[model samples]
Target: MPELLNSRVETCFQQAEAFFNRPFKRAQVSLKLRGQKAGVAHLHENLLRFNPQLYRENREDFLKQTVAHEVAHLVAHQLFGDSIAPHGEEWQLIMRGVYELPPLRCHNYAVKRRSVTRYIYRCPCDGSDFAFSAQRHGLVHQGRRYLCRRCRHTLVFSGETRVE
Candidate 1:
């Protein structure tokens, strides 16, 4: 599987080089990623990290979209430098024009539910609730304001927690 992923990544780099008429460094690949994300690209390190569990569950999508997505990040960074957004116009161009794939920001693979403690938050509109992970809850303490997607209102801590 790793060899296949490496081949897919190299193929994308080759495609990008041909499309842009320039050479791109081969990205280092790892299967160390975990949690909800399908993959991530470390632009500075020229690294691609894939969620091995997710890949095992959604093999085809991982090979097709995930590989291209991470490669596009490395390609865009090598071309446009670090000032551009992670999924900005440059990355989108690489995805569409170079790889000929949709510039999808996220994957829809079914993720395994992990045991986690969730901090409860509430939105004023309709008084809907949200469960925030400890990391995000800590960010809120550091002055990160979270908004409810459905109501578009600020989420306030309900002073509750859940273990699941």
Candidate 2:
């Protein structure tokens, strides 16, 4: 990561902790330069993704605001569970009281959205297809290779495929 990008990621985590009045011990922050339409708060796998282009274009103001936005979601879920409304009154209060951000509003950026691609694999002998979350897919020998249970054939990881 570039210096600016690393700084932004660290700053976002720091701001989030300060705003929540509680430190997030195990949370991880990451940047995705092209996944804006995927939303700002992706909580699965304990990761948060911020659009680098959006942060760069807006600089400090946008960085602080979005960090608050995503942190609100994380805090809310940790407290009240994931079924709660993402941007409801509880979230709004956290944004204000904890983060000291202005009143919440639906904010959108005009950046061009890019499609995410996933990798696909197949078993050469049995013709079983396997889909993976990452673009670069490979199989390691130390671990048990995902075999076609039905055909007992070794799986081969293929290449990336555009989903969009």
Candidate 3:
């Protein structure tokens, strides 16, 4: 599986190199990624991380789409620099023109999410409750305010918390 993934990544890089008319260094692939993300491209480090579980479950799609998707990120960064958006026109162009693949922003794999504690916040408009993760909850503690999109009102803690 690893060898196949490596080969696919190399093939993508070769396509990118030929299309962009520049040498692209081979990117390091790691299967250390967990959770929902199928893969991530660390542009600055020229590294790609793939979720082993997701890859094993969806091997063909992961190879054909996900590999090209991530490689496009690196190729786009190298050709257009960091000023361009991560999934901007440059990336879409590479996916369509170079690899002839769709420029999909995310994978649709069914991933199991680990249960975590959630902090509940409420919107003033209609008392709709919103659950926030620990990271966002901490950000709120540090005086960061989040607004409710529908109501256009600031979120306030409802003194509720849950673990599920």
Candidate 4:
């Protein structure tokens, strides 16, 4: 399953390399199937993260659609740079022209959510607007910091602190 996922991802990269006339060396990327997000592209670090659980449960769709979606982000970033909107025209073009897939911004997967303590967190941009997922909250507890994607401000926990 891992090999198959890597192959599909590599194929997308190769196509992008050929189309854009730029190289995305195999060694530069670190692909892993471990994350809460279905798929994420870290353009600065050249990392591609996918959720293995989601992939195993939805193999067909994951390979066909999710794979294309994540790879499109990398291709878009490489071709158009990070200044372009994450899912804007540049990404849509890659989805349609390169991967022959729809430019959908989000996925619909029935990922079960466990009832864990939700810690209230807010960034100045968000203004008392959000709660962290159990996994993310755990990370925060472990001293991992997260910044708001919108305003780039650090998130502050609103609830009382408790040591686990």
> Looking at candidate 3, what is the lDDT of residue 134?
93
TM-scores for all candidates?
0.71, 0.53, 0.70, 0.65
Order the numbered candidates by TM-score, best leading: 1, 3, 4, 2
Cα deviation of 19, candidate 4, in Å: 2.4
TM-score of 3: 0.70
**Ranking 3 against 4 by lDDT, winner:** 3
Runs of candidate 1 with Cα error greater than 4 angstroms are 116-163
How does each model score on lDDT?
0.91, 0.63, 0.93, 0.78
When summed lDDT is taken over every stretch of 10 residues in candidate 2, the lowest stretch is 135-144
- Model 1 TM-score is 0.71
Model 3 clash pairs are none
Select the stronger candidate by lDDT from 2 and 4.
4
Model 4, 81-161: lDDT tens per residue?
879999999999988988888998887877866445667788887485566777888898899988888888889888743
lDDT of 2: 0.63
Cα-based lDDT at residue 20, candidate 1: 89
> RMSD for each model, in Å, please?
7.4, 8.0, 5.9, 9.3
Task: Name the lDDT value of residue 80 in candidate 4.
Answer: 77
